[model samples]
Target: MNKLISELRRTALVAGDRVALSGEHEQFTYTGLIVAVDNLAEELSQRGVRRAALIADNSPAWIAVDLACLQAGVALIPIPAFFSAEQLEHTLTSCGADTLISDRRASDAQIASVLAGSTATSAFESQPQFRLWSLAVADQAASLPLGTVKLTYTSGSTGAPKGVCLSADKLFATAAALNTALLATPLQRHLAVLPLATLLENVAGVYAGLLRGAEVILPRVQSLGWAGSSGMEISDLTSCIDHWQPDSAVLLPQILKGLIAIAEQGHWQPPTSLQYLAVGGARVAPEQISQARDLGLPVYEGYGLSECGSVVSLNTPAAERAGSAGKILSHCDVDISDGQVMVKGNVYLGYLGGAELDSNDILATGDIGELDDEGFLWLKGRSKNLLVSSYGRNISPEWPESELLAYAGVGQCLVIGDAEAYCSALIFVTPGYSYEDIGRYIRECNQRLPDYAQIRRWAALPKRLTVADGMLTANGRIKRDVILHTYPELVAHCYPGIVYPIGGSQRAFTPTQTMNSQTDIDT
Candidate 1:
């Protein structure tokens, strides 16, 4: 129980006949994987490169490095492929990482340039040589404990990425907790759709998959058309799902939406082998899950944050609540305090910005949520995103956006902050969709919403916000600041109007008070 490597090594000894890891191009038996890890451990030990960064996409190599790091005690770091160049550079600098492993086929000149300039923390006096290797880059290894494993950075853009210091015990605790929950089902085979850098995936996807004696499938992000398209494109996803046929996978809600669309279009049939599609990152519509299930996709939602070691609350096949992120797991204690989630368990040791869990030990999750009597968690929205109107009522954009997403014409919504003017929204219409068609649809949709919650005025944007542009997470949460800054003109056209109810043949409602002619669209 020292490291995941030990468990994997032991399993490989007995499960040598079983398939341990699979990729778009390569598949390895348990024995083959153990040997690969042993070989890489030997090579890395020689290079004097104990600590390594696996910045590459999901592949056999990624899993190999992960295992190799454990075997050699190199203390590895997995870099999310969705990170921006600035975010990427900051992670490299923060981690004091001396070597990086990347996908050869996917590496662009720009990433190489970024790698060359990447520096280790200046504090480390006996720093090892920093280098970058493509997937094709030959194997090499150097040492153990990678000399007090450096910090792991999150996907947050608020500041220079804060490093989360984890101990061997903390990660081990996470694996044990997750393994106990999964019951180590041997018939399991996990297809990883999320980036391995995600704690949710690394712990629950890779480690859990391995410890369960499941074959972990790592599909190529590029082949899945994750390169140019928003990572959730349906056709590409259909192709990958058909090819890999994993028993389970952790999916973000955005990815679930695409999978739902694929089912709706009858473009593909979800694999008969598929089970346990764990959707998270944002609230998922129950209807979306139900529709997928009707079409034979075993999709459901779960809840976790990076700071909590990922698996805080999950909906399992054994025990599930359709609309709720099911019972909080035994590993952690979740309590609802003033509508916020407070967690205490084997969470992060501390953050780089010097934020420690208060003596109370509850990780103050800014999200507003409630716990049901059955212990299922129902999320309201972020307290920071709450919009209080002139009438003194708090309205969250997520509620309205969630409603709008249930409709067909809507693609993205940014409920605006307008206390003085009125509660307004900046809506991004879907691609090739006309305002007239959307307006007609929203007109019908208005019958379902209350007058105050109705979107008053909204404008169509030319395109969606992208991860590369810093306007989205890999999971596609609307980066509100980026949306407002990038589409200031669009927001200006939508607010402070006397909105009329949809489909009603009414001119408009008379204004009770004079307001700004056009909203400034500033956050």
Candidate 2:
């Protein structure tokens, strides 16, 4: 009884021949798309797959299998390709997934390790692009809430991520709201930029686009220039955008920054066809939004979490505020209680193995924000991330991080000052930017901040924080605890007295000091 599938059926009857999905090697019309879903759903039902996990890159076939699971009334778990082998094993085992659907081979070393305890059979003949494995592991004692359809895991900073159980009704409600939000500039060709495993892209990008009957572009992640979690080739991304000419896309803040760099270089121009480019997954600097607008990129900032069905508020062409997260979506009722953002009306069923919520239950989002007089929701930072300086002054790391990100040279940075004399930063610069460039940027950034919040000492990281190293989540949010645990030396080096051994040509500095003053530290 999924309304989205029913709507897809209705759309197919009228526009059966219209293109619904386009991938690198294949295309599916609306009619063809339905047929594929039906065939796979029938197979899944016959196989008695109560719960299944999907692991694959973005493609038309991936979408087909996803819809198939929905049609078959199977609870689906989507594990991102960027997840470590440990995470993959944890998800499959924790969710009691009876079957696994992936594009990876059964003989793959990582796959083999996770599937070791279970008896599995691959159905590679039926699905050419994907392998279907029936697992015979003991049914887990944990149970999903009644009516749960999709168990989407948040890319948590820890080794074991939690799965947010959601129903079809919740997902479609958010998608419907997103579709309505984009009514002013209807999408014709929507590109899938973020991995479909990401709930934000799955619900907002795919479901919303499909609701509007717009063509959803599903290119391979590599072709889109995605290199794992923290790396991307901006040139390849620009070429994809130029070639696809998509009218709509969802981007992470880093991607938007890269696009701005390309535009500033005058090497490329963003496609005029891109009418709506939604940026989220992190706090986007207002300066970045201004630069994007100046470059003709229709960038809108939105805010949401997986527990709220992926999106709660968005900045649309019709309604937008530069520094705000945007007006709350129609499907959501947001209230600020005790300086925390609480959401109701469109929350999830519950987490995996957790108590299900009643209809009246409110979700404490753990984010600090305020709703303006005009209904725009402006976010401050995460309440859990608020740092208390040694001076007893409260500071939000996101405040200084956002300022650093506004500059083109500063790629990624995290401000740390909890119980410290003053703020310190760990920085990763983009190519062609030197330590002096970053130092100058931080000095300028410090001028705008109060004395307590100003970053006094900084150090260059040997490399960017990446998901593989457990320093960043799949969506590129820094794992503060993991970074603190793994880089104790780097953190020590940022302080006034502590000296730590660091390899590579990295250096720790004060804004006013030259590199020659501090000893060279290598990563």
Candidate 3:
């Protein structure tokens, strides 16, 4: 057995009566958790389910199913609830998943629709808060690496999402390192704010909490203030924190921004019990970090990717730098090669249906970064995301975008303009901001940026970019290609010859006229 499952059994034996998991309608002690996992694993083993797909909201049953898969030695594939129907079908079919466990009736219908042609059998149960389905054929010969235990699909930049194969040891090691790095105590209570489908939350939040024998709050996403990929209710989230008073939580940059806004409004404050909050998923503005600290929120920034099994490095209370992702964890080795961050140790097996990544070969993280003398890693931006101007100057959009996000008015900004005279942006302002307010904030940001990277012109988005709009990934990273394709006319309006009216109208201009006007603006 792997170390994680063994530790979980030991924890259950040692702390049998202690609360191990909690949800909206149920709670489980360590003994209860162990019993639940064993029961489910027995059922799955009896059914000969070698691979199973899990699609459900955060709940005690979700954790139980995940643990049961580990116990049963079945390769588990967690399908994100936010995935499109087509994407979901592709994952299930490509992975040759033999069974599916999901909580929602709507999800059951969706799954049935996807498997309509197959001779699949279905069963409903109330105790586990999910229905079970057995497919007609299982692709017993699915191509996967040996010892593959988990298949996490990435929110792809284009086409269907790819599955990232990971071993149990790699994931457990990450969790154990995180638990040690954060100084997690057995008494600690962790709130699951992000979905379990997110590897970061799965490894660092759920796994770490289990490793420490900590009580994990596993409420559904809606109960935690998440509406969709990009929408959140700050008031609802603050209420959850105040009520739960969890010792630790993991968050994305946008979620932290929302909480900071509530704190700044004096409507809420970090609960005294809240000790460690790790923020990642995107580049956070240093100023925002300072603001969070000023608000008495222990917000620490970190960095990682799915290929690295979620967390590569993190900011712990014991060792932290303001703008860095913190020192690389003991589980991984990080180095910068020609401006790209390379990772070794605890790396993933590889993408499913693709080349098997050799562990000996250093995993070239597409992100650019630098390691400080203190061993802290600071990320610059994605290497491929660099924007080159007609003047041959290369600029990272994240640099200027981070500066823009520092302002309260700017909710999100996408900097673009490759081969153009000057840089331009598509700005998405927070509610209650006027055109003038956004423009003033942009000007302020422009002052801080280099001339080549300054936003000479920009247009406010009609609405926020969201997963529904195909503009953001499930974890909140911007889908640059989707945005560019979805709004070509709006992006073009940022150029000099094209005019964006105050009422949000687009007008095109002649190429020669546009070039001359842009040259003048550049000068």
Candidate 4:
């Protein structure tokens, strides 16, 4: 595998040359990017800054520091822009970061001092001691690392962050997987629709775009209807695509749905040069793919996690699977044991703060899946997240939730009866929708489901799902545990008493009994 820095150096030799990256941000030629990285690398080394945390909005420099890490061999931790101040404090301190990087707009001294103090072990809940630097100033002293590349955290440690260590070579290897999958040669152009911080998008979206020598487009967040500073906006995305016209890109399921919506509204046109649309991060409804296809979009499903440097499986332009998260990429060595997906190759070194990963460094992904006769993999559900009823039956909630989405005005629904007395759900309906109408809609939806699989009762959440509320991920999947934790009252209404398992002496129902929709409504 080519080390990340070496690849950049090789690509930059021609200078003023090189193509778009991952078909998103129209970054500088290899020569320009190399020079910038080299300069940044020198600046960091001169200051003797071995490790730094990158906290900033979307910008070309964000990725520069990322690549500079590869060159300097210093590990980089990227905090998502959407992370709250509290979340940020925990992540930075937990990672023991020494230097902090941010944009011009975020040059608050108090915030900087607080962040710097987090690195000190003694700081604990208090901020550590460190130096904060703004993007405007160029460090006179920078050096490139010949070692580890980057460290990313994903909700693993509960309170503190867990780091996934990816070497420059592995990061580059992940990018290489896409070159073949995307048919991305020197001529293609890709766009970065998702955040650059995510390992999945960072590796596949940006690095893959570069491997093909393609132009990468990254539009402003505001243009995309991202009301907050964190996620991408639809308006910005459509505008970027219409203006630059990229060939390939990566997106989450919801973004694909949004594109389909825009096309249905006749507001955007599918690019003539466009080829692959990689979708992943959460379970994408099969119908969502069909709907996008009806609008002339070629959206391919994918599956991955931060530990795998983002991509584990992708449906390449060559071997396409409609519903399955394409075949495992060349970079990942995947196997299914006992209905669970286990992967090892290119796995992260360990979590942050010196805690070791599971035995054998193999990530036994909790996600349940199966490989078909043709070898295409389809996801079923999460093992840990599976809901078990008081009646001793385990239920895969996603199976039922996907069915609910097909109903009009049914925005989001969470099946929450795991280890509980009876099955119930917490639903977030489409804006301005009435709970009365939703009840009718769910009743109809339930009629189509088996008795065991049907939701017995439901409660409407007062608020819409949002990242701010921790109810949704960046891709818009319900944060199951977070939702339940925030709305215990709603949860309790469905399962009134402590869930008790049915005894062995339980008897069968009488022949005179008739079916009922929910126990709430007396039959």
In the range 1-523, model 1's lDDT, one tens digit per residue, is 3566777778888878799888866788888887877887777776666557776667777777676776776767776554556556666555556676555322464256554544433211111222344222122321222223425655442324456656555566665666665563333778777666767777778877887788888887766656421234668877877887777887765567667777778777888888677776666678878988998888767777666776788777776888887778877888889889888876665664354543247788787889988878888777686554432223566766776677666887677743422346565667776556666665554444433345655555556668997878999887887666666555545643334234323222222223222222222
Query: In candidate 4, what are the lDDT values of residues 321-361, reduced to their tens digit?
Result: 77798888788788889999988786766655454543257
On TM-score, the leading prediction is: 2
- State each model's CA lDDT, in order: 0.64, 0.81, 0.77, 0.63
lDDT of 3 by residue, 1-523 (tens): 8788788889988889989999998999998988888888887887788988888889888888898899999999998765656667778878888787777664364465765654434443325456667755445435888778999975443235678899998899899888778774333799999888888889889998988999999888888887644457878888898888898899877678778988999989788898888887776778888899899888888888788888988887788888888889889999899999999988889888777876685799888899998789998777697664533334677777888889888888798876465678777769987656766677776665545567777766667888886789999999887676666665666774545333233232222444334322221
Which window of ten consecutive residues has the lowest lDDT sum in model 3? 502-511
Residue 343's lDDT in candidate 1? 84
Misplaced by over 4 Å in model 1 are: 105-107, 117-151, 184-187, 353-360, 386-523
* Per-candidate RMSD, Å: 12.5, 11.5, 12.1, 13.2
Q: Which 10-residue window of candidate 1 scores lowest in summed lDDT?
A: 121-130
> How close is every model to the real structure, measured as TM-score?
0.68, 0.77, 0.75, 0.67
Question: lDDT tens digits, residues 93-160, model 2?
Answer: 78888888888777775577777655556563446778778776556736999989999876443346
TM-score of 2: 0.77
